[model samples]
Target: MITDDKDFEAKSIIARMQRIDKWPLPPSFLAIIALGYFFTFYDVTDIGFAMPSIAPQFHLTGSESLFLALSIGLIGYVIGSFIIGYLADRYGRYPMLILTMILMALGSFGDAASVNLDMLIVFRFITGLGLGADLNLIPAYIGEFAPAEKRGHLAQITFFLGILGQAVTPFVALAIVPPFYYGWRVLFLIGGLIAVIAVVLRAELPRSPRWLIGHDQIKKADDVVSKFENYLKSNGETLPELKTDDINKINVQTETTRLSFLYLWQKPYRLRMLVFGLWWGLWYIGNYAFLGDAATILSDSGISLASSILFLAIGAIGYPIGAISSWAISDKFERKYIIFVGSILWLIGMLIFGSKANSIALIVGSFIASYSLAFLIGIAYMYTSESYPTRARTSGFAMGDGLGHIGGAIGALFLPLWVAEIGFFGGFAFIGITTLIAGIILVVGGSIATRQQLETISA
Candidate 1:
C-alpha cells in the first residue's frame, strides 16, 4: 500500500507530474487508466445482451422483468456509490478501488451460483454495489492523476470502455449465453475473470500523490512520487524534483474533514449538485429506459431479434466514438454546451423515432438517438468529474449517478407499461419530451463548478 508521508519541497501537482517522467506511449497514463476501466465496464454492460433471453426465463413482465435486472442492481449501486465514494476520500482512492473490484468479482461469482429470481436479484445487487463504487471512484482517480491538458482525454476512457463493453455484449452472448444450462452464469464469471486480471495489472499503479499530500501524508506522497519517477526512468525518462511552490498548491488549506454525503447539498455546491444529478437522471430516462425496453419495443413493431440486436449494437458503437471525440474536446468547451447538444440530438432523434416506429426510417432514427445518447453520457461523465473539488468529486458523481440510476429505475417501471398501454411510439414520445425538458434546464443555467476551473482561472 502506498503511504502518505515523505520529505520534499511542496509544489503544484501538475508541475510535479510533468517533471517526474514521461512514458514512451502517447499519454501512457491513459493506457493504464483505460485498461483498469475496461474490466470495470465489461461487468456493467455484459448483461444487456442477456436481457432479452433472461427476461423470458425468469418469467418477467416487460417492465417488471427488466426492472428486476436493472433497477435492483442500480438501487444497490446508488447505495454503494454513496458509501464507497465517501470512503475513497477517507481511505485513499487506490485502496478503495481494489476493494471495490474484489466485491464486484465476488458478486459476479455469487450471481453465477444463484438458483432463483430472489437469489439472482440479491447477487445482482451485490454486483451493482461494487460497480457503483467503480463508477464513482475511477473517474475521480483518473482526473486527479492526469495533467490538465489530457484530463478529458483520460477521463473519457471510462465512458469509452462502458460502450465497448456494450458493443461486445452480442458476441459474448452468442458465444456464452445459453444452449448450455449455465449460460447466464457464464456472464458473471467472465466479469470476475476480467476484474482479477485488472487487479494484477494495477499492482504497479500508485495512489494519487496529490490526494496523499492533501491529507497531510507528505512522506507517503513523496514515496509515491519517487516510485513514479523511478518507473519513468525505467521507461527512459528523467526525474524532476517537486518544487515548494507547487507543493503549497497541492496542499491548499481546507477545514472540511469527513467528506459527508451532506456536503453535496451545501451552498454553491448545491446548485452544481442539482445540475449534475438531474441531468444524469434525465439522460438515462432517454437512454437506458429506451434501450432496456428496446427489444420489446421492436418486437411489438414486428421487427426480428436479429435486426433488433444489430441496430442496437450499431447504436452502441456510436458511444465510444463520440466519447473519444468529446474527451478530446471537453477542455475546450463549457461542460453545459456539450450536454446541451447531446440532449438536443436525443430529443430530435427520439421524436423522429417515435413518430415513425413502423417505418425503416424509425430504425435509422433510433440508431441516431442511440448515438447521441452515448455522446451525452460521455459528456455527462466529464462534466460530473469536473463538477466537484477533488476532495468531493467521487461523492458528487455518486449522488449524481445515483440520480441517473433512479431514472433508469423509473424507465424500468414505466417504459414497458407505456408501451403496453399507448404503444411503443407513444412511450418513446413521452420520454423524448421529458429528456428535452432536462436539456432545457441545463441550457438555462448549468455551468462548470469544479475546482479544476478555479485552478485554471487562478493560473
Candidate 2:
C-alpha cells in the first residue's frame, strides 16, 4: 500500500511539472477554430446558391424566396446572439461554443432532409441560432486565447474562412445542381456534413483559461493555462508570462455567475451597448445586402453560372486579401480608421456600380465594394472586441452583432423587391446609402468612445 501511494504521488508531481513548462499552440485548438468559422461562413453563403432552386420549389416570388431564406435566419440569430452572449459571460466561452455547434449540427441535419418549405424554414432558423452564437462568441473566444499582438491576425482567420466558404457555395451549386435532383438540398446536406465534422473537432478543443479565471474557477483555469503553456513550450514557442499586476488591471469582482442583458445597460456599459448596437445593425444591412444579392445581380448582366461562379470567387478573394492586409497594418493605426476607409470605399464602389449598370464597370465596382466590405467587417471585429472590458467582452460583441443582424434581415428581405423594381443599379444605390450613413455614424461614435475611455474596463 505504501509503494502504491508513493507511485501515485510521483505521478502527480510529474503532472504538475508538465503544467509549468510553456509550450506552443496546440494544433487541435487551431483546427477547432478553423472548422467552427468555416461552417459559420458556409451557412451564410449556402442560402444564396440555394435561392434559385428554392424559388421554384416553393413557388416563391423573387422577394418572397429571398425573404424566406434570410429573414428567418436573422430572427433566430438575433435571439441566439443575445442569449449565448449572456451565457458565455456567465458560464464560459468554451461551453457556449460547443453548445452552439451542437445546435448548428442538429439544425443542419434536420434541414438537409426537410420535406417542405415550412420545415426547411424551421431548420434554417435553428441553424441561424448557431450562427448567431458563433458571431457573438467565437471571436471573443479567440481573442481571449490569443497573444495580444497576434490577436488581430488570428481573429482575421475567421473572416478569411468565412469568405472562402461563401466562395465555395457558388462553385458547389454549379457543380452539383446539374446532377443532383435538388441542388439546394445538396447545400443543406453539405452544411450538415460540415457541422458534424466541426462538432467532433471542436469537442477536442481546450476551454479558454481566461474564461475560467473570469468565472473564478482559479484552480481549473490555472490548469488549463498551464497545459496551454506546456503545449507551446513543446512546440518551441515561449508562453506569455502572466504578471499579477497585469491581471489586476482587467480583474473585476463579480459573483462569477452568468451575466445578463441587464448588466450591459448599467453605467458606462450602456453607452457602449447603444453605440455597438447601432454599428452592428448598420453593418449588417450594408454587408448582407451586397452578399445575398451578388449572384442575382450578376445573373441579370447575362453572366452564366460558370462565369458568375468564377467572378464571385474572384470577388470573394477580396475579403481574405483585404483582411490579411488589414492585419499587417492593424497595430499601426486605430481599428476604427481602417473600418472608415473600407466603408468609404464601399460607398464609392456601390455608387459607381449602381450608376453604371449592365457594364463591366459595374462588375468591377461591385467586386471592389465586396472586398472593401470584408475589410470593414474584419476591422469591426477587432474594434468591437477591443471596445469592451474583458469581463463583459462576449456580451458586447453579441449585443452589437445581434443588433446588426436586425439590419441584415431588413436588407435581405427588402433588397430583392427593390432590385426587381429598380434594377441592380437602384438596389446597389440603396445599399450604398445605408453603408455610407453607417460609416458616418461609426466615425462619429468612435470619436465619442475614444474620448470616454471606457474601452478597457477594470472589473
**Candidate that would win on lDDT:** 2
Q: Which residue window of length 10 is worst by lDDT in model 1?
A: 1-10
Please write out the lDDT profile of model 1 over residues 57-157, one tens digit for every residue: 77766455667876787788888888888888777788888777777878888877777678878988988888888877877777666556556655666
> For candidate 2, lDDT tens digit of each residue in 1-459?
114443333233223322232212554566567677778877887776666566666776657666876678888898888888777877778788888888898888777777777887898899988888887777777665665545566667666765567556656777775346687787778888888887777777777655554455556755766676566566676534544344333323333334556666787667777877887787678678767766665665677655555566555656666667776666466667777888888888788777754556655775677678667776687577656665677777887888789899988877767777888778878887777777777778763222122223322
Report, for all candidates in order, the number of backbone clashes.
Answer: 14, 14
The reply for model 1, stretches above 4 Å from the true place, is 1-15, 18-29, 174-182, 229-251, 355-363, 449-459
TM-score of 1: 0.85
How much lDDT does each candidate structure score? 0.67, 0.68
By summed lDDT, the worst window of 10 consecutive residues in model 2 runs over 449-458
Tell me the lDDT of candidate 1: 0.67
